[model samples]
Target: MNDAAMPKGPATALEHFDVLIVGAGISGIGGAYHLKQQCPGKSFVVLETLESFGGTWLTHTYPGIRSDSDLYTFGYRFKPWVGPPIATADEILKYMGEVIEENDLSPHIRYRHRITNATWSSRDNLWTVEAERLDTGQAVAFTCNFLWMCQGYYRHSEGYTPEWPGMADFKGRIVHPQTWPDDLDLKDKKVVVIGSGATAATLVPAIADDCGHVTLLQRSPTYFIPGRNANELADILRELKIDEAWIHEIVRRKILHDQDLFTRRSFEEPEAVKQELLAGVSAFVGPEITEKHFTPSYRPWRQRIAFVPDGDIFQCVNRGKASVVTDEIERFTEQGILLKSGQELEADIVITATGFNLNVLGDISFAVDGKPLNFADTVTYRGMMFTGVPNLVWVFGYFRASWTLRADLVADFVCRLLTHMDEKGARKVTVELRPEDKDMPLSAWIDPENFNPGYLMRGMHLLPKRGDKPEWQHSQDYWREKEELPLIDLDDSAFVYAGTKARTPEPVG
Candidate 1:
C-alpha cells in the first residue's frame, strides 16, 4: 500500500521498485535493459501505454509497413540494425528512438501510463501496480519486486476491425491494416484487400501503386513466400569490420537456423520437400492463379507464409494491378463487397487484412491475493514464468522464428534470472516447467495448434525443449540462442528462488 496510500480517482502512488515494467514494448524495453544491466542497484519502471515509444513500431500505421523479419534478423541482440533490409515504420521508429536515447531510457519511462491492474501481495512480497493515465484520466499506483509483462498481443491500439456486414453501410473508406487511415487517398480508387495474411500479403503490393483496382479478398489459403531481405548482407557485414554485436548475433542465429530448418523439413516431410515447396509456389502463381488462389488447405508449416518481396505479391497479381479474390466476405454493401459466391465486389476502399486482436498478454489484469487472474487457470512457466505466478514475467514471441529471435531469448532469460537472484540474496523468482515437463512431444513448432492463444497454448507448456544441442533447447535456433542465452551460465537448477525484504525506495510523484 504505497504511492502514498492509494485513493483518489485516477489514482497515483509510487515507491517500491526493483522492477515493474508493463509495456514499454520491444519486450518492455528489452526487459528493462536487461534488468538494468543485471541489477545495477535495482529499481525500475517503464509502464508506457503510449505517449510514444515504438511498441509494434509505434502502433503500426498501415500502407506498406515492412519488417517481416530481416533487419539483421529483426534487430536487438544488444542493438544492431545499422539499417535496411525491410525496416521502415519510420525506420523502426527511429530505431526505437535510438534505443530510448541510448539507454538513458527516458528517465525510466512512464508515458501515458495505462497498466490497469495487477496484484500479488502475499504479505508484501510486492507487485501492486494499477495505472490508467490515458492523458489525465488519472489512476495510478505502484509497488514492485518484479512484474515485467511486455504487452504484445493487441487490444485495439487501433486495428483488427472485422464483422463486415454492410459495414456501417459501406459508402467507402473502411481500412484497418491496424488502423491505416493517414488521410485516406487511394488515387484512382477501387481498392479492397480483405485478408490472406501478413496484412494481406503486405497490403497488396503496397496499395498497388496507389490503387485503381486491387481486390485481394481471400478467406483462406496463404503461403505466399518470396521475401528477399537484402541490406546487401548488412552491407557486407559493415564492410567486413563485422561486430555490430557480432553481426546481430550472427544474423540472428542464421535466421533462427533457417526458420527451424524450414519448419522442420516442412512439417516432417510433406510428401518430400514440402511438395517441392508447394510446387515452387505453384510455379510462382501461374496456373490460373495457382488453381484460383495459391492453393492451401493448411499444410506448409500449417499457417504462416506471407513474405512477398521479389515476387511482390506475385508481381502485383500478374500485372493486372492486383486481383486475387479467393472469396468469402459474404456481406457489406453501400458501394460493394459481398461475396460468398454471390459476388458483388466494387469498393473504393475497404482494406481489413483481417487478423490480430488476440489480447492474451496485453489484456493485462492479473491478481493473486485478491484472487482474479484466470489467465485460463495459469500454466506456462518456462515460456516465461506463470505456474502460480510469483515475481512475474511474460515477454512472448516466435510465431515460428524471428520475433526478435524469441525476443532476444527472452532478454537473455531475464538477465539470467536477474543474475541468479543477485547472487542468491534472492528476493523472488519463478521459472516453472515440470509437470513431468510435459513428457516429450513439444515442438510441433511450439504447438497448441500453432497459437490461437490458450494463453499461447498454455505458454508452450513452459518452453525450452527442442534439444539435440542448442544448449538444452527452446532454440528457435538463432545459433542456439547465441549459445543458449548469451553465452550461458547464470547458475540454474531451473530457477525457483524466494527470500524477501530489501526493496524499499519509491516516491517519484
Candidate 2:
C-alpha cells in the first residue's frame, strides 16, 4: 500500500476505466491478467481497500498459517508453482508477489481505496462507484462499463469469535487467529486454542514445540486426512531429469485428479469415505484419541475435510507437547477455563481460531437504475452474474476444489463476455430472468442446512439465490465446469444484449 505514491490531498478529476475490479487479491490479480491478455483494449484497474495486496495471505499472520489445500490446486493455472504443493503463508505470499511483479500489475492497482457504493444507471449504461481513500479520507469516483467483484466473501477486518462466559474477565491474554499480534510472545506459555477448524489444526502443531503446551478445545470432532506436503510425482520427475514444465503439468493434473476422486467418493459413498478418513486419523492419533477427539458426528465432507501433513498435530499431542479436548466451554476463568464436562483447563493465553464473518462484494452497497439491488431477488447466471444486475460478475471460487481453479475459470469467462459484448456492439448488457423463469421456484445460494459451515450458514441471507435452470445454478463440481464454462453460449436468452451506451455521471468532488 504505497499511499505516498497516490495523489495527495483531495481526489481531483474523475477516473474512468473500461472495467473496475474491487479487489487486488489473488482473484483480482488473475482477473486483471485475463483482462489484459484476452481483452487487450479494455482498460481496467484493481481497487484494494487494504494498504497492500495478497488478501487473506496478507491479512492472516497466525502461528501456523498455511494453505489448507495443496498449492498446485491453489496456485494460478497460467503460472507454474515450482515449490512444494503445500506452502506456508509467507511462501505463498512470495509466490503471489512474484506473479504480480512479473506480470507488471502493480501500476494498475490502487491500494487503500475502499469502494462504498455502486450505482448503475440503465439510461447511461455504466456504473458510478464511490470510494474513500483511506490515507486521506478523501472521496474518489470512478465509472466503468463493467464491475468485477474479486474481493472474496469473508470480512477481512473481523473474524468470528464466539462469546464465552467470563471471556472479558479472564486475566490471561486473549487473541484471535485473524488478528494475531506479531510481538505477542507465546514462548513457554500455556495456550488454549478454541475451535477445531483448519486454523486450529494448523496452530496446535505449529507452536507446540516452543509453547509450554497447546490444548485444542472443540465442541465437536472434525475429520482429518494425512498426506505428504510435497508431491511425489514431482520428485520422481526431477529424479528422472524431466523438464520443469512437463513435471508441473503432470503433477498438477495428478493432484487435481486425486482431489476430484476423493470429492466424488465423499459425495457418492460418504460412509466408505468416512471410514477410510477416520482410519487415517486412527493410524496417527491411535484408536483411543481418534474415538474421543477425531470422530465427527456428521458424515464426511458435510463440512470441509482438513488435510494434515504427516499427521503433525497428532504427533504433537502424542508427544505431550499438545492436547485436544472435546468439550463445551462453561466459562473462562482468569487462570483458564471450565468445561461443560466437569473438567477445568489451565491456560496463560487463549487463541480463538474461530471462522470468519462473510461479506459479499466487499460489503459494497449496490443499486441499478436508481433502484436498490437486492441479491435475494435475483438469480445467479452461470454462478457469476445476477439476473437483474448488468455487467457485473462476482468471483466466488469453489468450496470443494482449489480456489484459483475457479478464479481462472471466472477470469476467462468474464473476458469472453466482455469480448462478446464488444463484437455485438452492445452498449448495456443485463441478465434478466426469462418470462418463464417467473414461475420457477428460487432456491438459496446453497443448502446451508445440508452443508452447514459456520460462515456460509450465517451469511446465507446475504448471498444470491439460484433458479431451477442449469444456467442459473452454481455447480461446485470443477470437472463439470472445466468442460462447460469456457463454452458459454452468447446467444442464451438469459442475457439481454443491446447497443445502449452507458450514462456518464457528474464530476467528482
Candidate 3:
C-alpha cells in the first residue's frame, strides 16, 4: 500500500478533481454553486469549449437576441434577476460574468477545452477524460470521480441548416444565425428570414426598421403568444420601497404559477387555450392575416410556442416594414428564392433562422471498461442520470418552464447524492436497471413520432431511451418533478452503492 507503488499511466499524468463539470453555462454555473454550498470539500473544474463562460448567450449574437423565458425563473435560484423580465443576450452574459467573478469561478474555468472523449473505470472509480484545445488542437486530459454534463442539448459547432434545391445558385449573401459574422453589414437591404421559429420571430422585428424590407418566410405556421416586455409589478413595488429579495421571490412564484396553469390548460383543455392565443394575435393584425400566418396546424404545447414581446412581430407586419409568407421554397435563383407557388422573393441577404440540432452531451464519445457506451442501449433515470452509467449526470432543462428551474433542482439533487456518497464512504455509485424491471416497456425518449419539434426529431435516435417505470421515467412536467426529485427515497435497489472499485483506471488512445 505504498504511495509510490501505484501504476503511472495516462490517468496518472493528467490533472484530477473530485467533480468535473462539462460546461460553464447556466446549469454548469449553478452546479458549481451547489457543489460549493453543499459539499465544500469537493474540488471541481468547469471545462468550457468556447472562449467565454456564457454558453448560448455568448455564442448567439443575432440582433434582438433575448430570453424566451422570463429572467425571474431563468436566473439562478440563489441569485435575483432585478433587471427586465426578458433580458438581452449582452445583459445575460454580463450577469454570468458577475457570477463568475463574485463566486470566484474564474480560475476554475478552462476555456477552449473541448472534451472529446470520456472513459470510466470500475476499479479506480474515476473517469479519464480527453479533450482538445479548439485553437491549437493540443490534446488535454483530466480525471474526476464524477462527471457532470450541463452543455445544453445542442451542437455548438454548427446549427442545423437543411440543404434546399439549387441553394448554390443563390447570388445573395446567405447567413445562418448560429454562425453569424461580426463585420457583415445589412443596412437598408431587402432581407428575408426563412423560418417561423423563435429565432426568426426575434430577428424579423429587430431588423424591420433597419432593413429596407424584411419578410418571415415559413413553410408552416408556428404558435405566437404576445407577452409583456416589462415587469409592471416590480416597478410598482419599487415605488412602495419593497426589498429586491422579496420582489424577486414574489415575482418568481407568480411566474411559476402562471406557467404551470398555462401548461395544464394546454394539455387538459387545448382548444380553449388555442382560441385565446389566436384571438390575441387577431387583435393585433386582423383575422385574415392571423388565419394566413399566425394560426398553427398543431395544438399548443405540442410544439414550442414562441412569445413575441408586445406583439413586435405583428406590429412590424402591420406597419408594412415586415411581411409574412406562408410558403415552401421551390429553388434558389440568382436574384432570390423562388417559391413553390410561382412567387419570387428578391433578397439582398437571406438569413436562415432555423433552429439547432439536439446534441446530447455535446456529442462526446463515452466508454466504460473499454467497451463503447451507446446511449440508445441505455435508459434514463429520473431525467438526469442514465442507467448503467456510473457517476454521470446529464443536465437537460425544462420544455414548458424556465430552463433554470429544472437545472437548480438537478444541481441540488446531485449535491445531495455526492454528500451521501461521501458520508457513506462509498467509492463507486452506479445506476442500473433492476432485473425485475427488465420487461418494462422501454420506448424512445419522448417517442420520436410524438415529438413534433424538428431539433429533437433530427437527433432522436441518438438520445437515451426511457421506460414507463418510475425510476426509468423522464418527466417533462416541472411541478411534478419539483415535488418528486428532492424527496425521492434514495434507498432503491436499482442504484448500486459499493465501497470497492472493480479495476484500476486507464486511458484510451
The Cα local distance difference test for each model comes to 0.69, 0.86, 0.85
Q: Considering summed lDDT, which 10 consecutive residues are worst modelled in model 2? A: 1-10
For candidate 3, report its TM-score.
0.94
Deviating ranges (above 4 Å) for candidate 2 = 1-11, 503-509
Instruction: State the lDDT at 492 in candidate 2.
Output: 82
Candidate 1, 1-509: lDDT as tens digits: 43434444745556567778888767777677777776678778888888777777777778778777666666677787777666768887788778888878889988887777788876667788887776666677888887877878666566556575778888878877776767899889998887777777887888798888898887776666674556455568779898788777776666666767777787677567555655666666766667668777756755556556676888877788988878787789999888889979898888776776557666667788888876544445435565567887677676655666677677767766766677788777655544445453434225444334233343443233342222223333344455555655545544567775645545664
List of clashing residue pairs for candidate 3: 123-503
> CA shift at 415, candidate 3, in angstroms?
0.5
Order the numbered candidates by lDDT, best leading. 2, 3, 1
Report the number of the highest-TM-score candidate: 2
Per-residue lDDT of 147 in model 2? 94
